[model samples]
Target: MMMPAAPETDAVRLREAMTESLKTSGALDDPAWRAAVAAVPRHRFVPGFYLPAQEPDEHGLTVWEPVTADADYGRWLAAAYSDRTLITQFDEQEPDWAAPRVRHGGTPTSSATLPSLVLRMWADAGIAEGHAVLEIGTGSGYSTALACERLGSAGITSLDADPKRLETAATALHSCGYTPTLAVADGWYGYWPEAHFDRVVAVCSFRAVPPALIAQTRPGGKILLTLSGWMYGYARVLLTVSGDGTAEGTLLPGTVSFMSARSHAAPAFGNPAHWVAGLPEKARPVRHGPERITAATAEAFHLRYLAQCAVPDAQLTTFEDTVVLVDVVSGSAASLTPRGPGWDVREAGPVRLWERIEGVLDAFDASGRPGPGRFRLCVRGDEQFLSHPRLPSLPLPSVGYGRASTTGPSASRRMPGSGR
Candidate 1:
């Protein structure tokens, strides 16, 4: 009879397999990235993770079950080496991996972002040998370990708001022979004491590029992060910081998303019904039907993003027949119901949500319906705006154009692959 292999042997085998898989998939095109992937053990970083159950628990939110290494090392190691975003924390609470445990009705505050994603972002940022890197969001430290393999531990500085996560990442990095700088601070602010990093890569999405990032980065350095919105639109951008404290860049082709930074996240707005409760009917008829705006067509998908530009503060919710836009902070709400030829629109509060969305949609159509890919972003100090050759430059989430929240981007649309 054959004896079982040691855990270390299995870990090496699995890590090799995962690296090969990433290379085959084109995620690890650079040999240096591949070597880093091959060298650093991913299983060391993610000891366990949470997977959602098919049925939600008492709370309406999905309940996630924990898989732990102490309970089953074989399974945990296999999964850790896989190419998936492992849910590490739910509302700041790491799952009780002591046994099979579950968390319900809580948001994924942090995670070990997918391996391909880590490699992809590193490639996009052009992280290289001898270049110092500042990584935002050090969850499990898997990405940081890969960076260590590429640039050595001394060249990397990574931070997270959660001290526990940083502690865990530090332990994991040490085990893999990496002891990079791991600090506990809000990633949105960047590492304050450190300055002049060659590349700043954020695993989390931001509503606007933090001005602190531009100030800290070397004049020609790059800031790689996803620019998300209240509508949950993801635009991964690579910004090159300038000496004048201004940064500008074009959107990367792919749709990449991460959980919004706590500061940039949509404000908490409870119950859509509360905002739509009592709104007066519109006095004038509108030109277009709400059907066009609430549509399932490609145009509607694009329209959702366009609406995000116009009304940064309104959260959208849909019912069987009607769609509602509620801006809890502004005390503004728009209710759309069917009428004979057009939609019956109602409004309450300071801003007219429907009229704004209509105006944006009209402009989008008139601009020949440009896809989001053609857009460019310019960041100067605090404000950031989206620009295209034809369309107008619209303010992004940071400036607080208006106060809106997100129950989600839309009831019908699924959040992208990032899971955050």
Candidate 2:
């Protein structure tokens, strides 16, 4: 009698399926990237992860259910190869890998970033054979595996702030036969021992490009990262390091959000009432009529980016039809609501939050509401400035205009006065 043919392992079949899906979705266009995806077993890296349940629990928190291969191989394998982010840690706590279920109330501290996004960033980094890459935030080592496949193991160095994450990534990478340099250190300070990387890619978002990254990158090296701000506005940025240590680049035409680096994470904000109470005694109303601009609108996305660039630490909260702006450090607060023909504006705080916003909105309007791609970033040492070729570079403090070109017509125009 002929024996039945042996069944293929679920991990192998799933990985192949995932590779095909990625190619079909146009996410794995590069043959090498596709091969990398196929070669590495993602299931091994993420043994257990939390998935949001359809219904939340009694505490008004989303119920995160744990999934493991032992209990249910099908679901686990499906999730492993699926193009979705898997939360590996919550509130800096790693969930029990063997637990059948668990609930997490804290924010996601670490995760395996979506595969498509990882490939996109990798493609943008322009990693070629023999290129030495320094990867920041080696969360799951999935990206590291891909880089290793493209560039040999000797050409990759991955760093993470969390020691636990580093340990986990090292094991996963080794299991996949990749022995990239893994270090437990702050990503803000690029691994100095191994300097002069051909490319630097940050998996986490940053308010500003770390000077160390620029210093460690070889001239003409590319740096890919997601630049985010207090408003939660994010844009993918690709910068080319210059010989003088200054890097300049334009914002790519897309939106990407990632967890902030642990070291650079924003401080927790106190009660909003405290900020509102600290406002100046005098109250004011805005002159402009009710505008359609808002944080949710597509066109306003770039405006939000500009707003965050102007006030790096400002926080925005929206409810119903009103938008509340608060700066914890400066103790400034402003509430703008639609009333009658114009917005009812309330201002309190030393920072003149409403007036600052008004000036930014006016500037945005004057510029015909340009897209985020029009914005350019110039990094000189620790200071980074965002400007438009058509508009004067607005240094951080002015909150209005930047240095104007003498020869050519100035994109810098006088900001409209704030209505008191």
Candidate 3:
């Protein structure tokens, strides 16, 4: 009779299968990355993670259930090696796999990103041999292990905001025989001791590429991350740092997103009625449909991205065919509703919120409507902005914007990849 394959042997086989799947999916093309994926056992990092259960909670939000290795070894290993993103922590709560209770509803605060996407970012960031890398948001340490496998532990420095996560990631890395440098600090502030890395890559999302990251990178080094906004739009950005403390690059083609840095996420905006009550009674008709600007359609996705560059802190809300954008801190608000052929809008507050959004969409149209490929990013000293050759350079929103608060319904958004 044939002997049963050992658990570790099974892991090797599953890891190899995942590598092949990524190859076929076009998420990975480099032979070095393929080898890294084949060698590391991802199950070591996420022995237990959460998956969205089919059932919705009483509030109609997604309910999450844990998939622990102890509960179901076969299923757990399979999911760990699968291409899907595995959520490891929720609402900043450290998950207790032993208990394995069903979570009614909570935001995903940490996750092991989709396997294929992790490898893709490795390739996209152009981290080659002998290059020292500073990896931001060491959530699972899976990516760090992959880097250590090819680049070696001595040159890879991984950082995360939570001390608990860094401790957990350090343990996982040690199990994988990696002793890469691990630091605990907010990714926005960046790790300072190990400055001037060859590459700086963030798995987390940001409103703008933090100046600290640019300051930490070597003169010729590259910085890769996704720029996100309260509007729920995301775009891939890669830039080369300069000697004068600046970086410039264009948006990479294809869709991309990531969980916002906790400090960078949108603040709760209280009640809609309160803001709506402040708007003017009369409304003005506009040329374009509100759907074109606010809908989740593929056509409008990039349009929202443009609007985000114009006004990063502008939060979106929609109800009963009416769409509104609010600059809560600046006391700006606008509401739009469908009219005969176009839409009618009412504006209020200091900033002309709707007018700015409408102007951006119009400018984009006048420039032959270049796709996301035409988008450019430039970071200069304290200011960061997006610029197009034909259009004006739009400055990113300033940080520390305040919000009004009152009990209210949750705003609707179309953020993909539940979170990290």
lDDT of all the models against the reference? 0.76, 0.75, 0.80
Residue lDDT tens for model 2, 56-88: 778668988887776666777789899999998
Query: Which prediction has the highest lDDT against the true structure?
Result: 3
In model 2, state the lDDT of residue 345. Answer: 75
Q: Tell me the spans in candidate 3 whose CA falls farther than 4 Å from its real position.
A: 1-6, 293-299, 340-342, 400-420
Clashing pairs in 2: 279-348, 279-349, 280-349
lDDT of 1 by residue, 135-167 (tens): 988888999889888988888888777777777
Model 3: how large is the Cα RMSD against the reference? Answer: 7.4
Model 3 has how many clashing residue pairs? 0
- Model 1 segments more than 4 A misplaced: 1-5, 55-60, 282-303, 319-321, 337-344, 398-420
List the candidates' TM-scores in order. 0.86, 0.86, 0.90
Off by over 4 Å in 2: 1-8, 58-60, 277-298, 318-322, 338-342, 395-420
Clashing pairs in 3: none
lDDT of 3 by residue, 1-420 (tens): 222346577788888888888889887678888888888889889977998988898888888888876677787788888999999998898977778788887888899999778887888889888787988889998998999998888888887787777778888888778888777767776666666678999999988777777777889899999888898888888899999889998988766678888889888887877888789999998756666655766557777778877777689888557787888678888888877778899998878787888788888889998887787888886678888989998887655322211112112221121111
- State the lDDT at 13 in candidate 2: 84
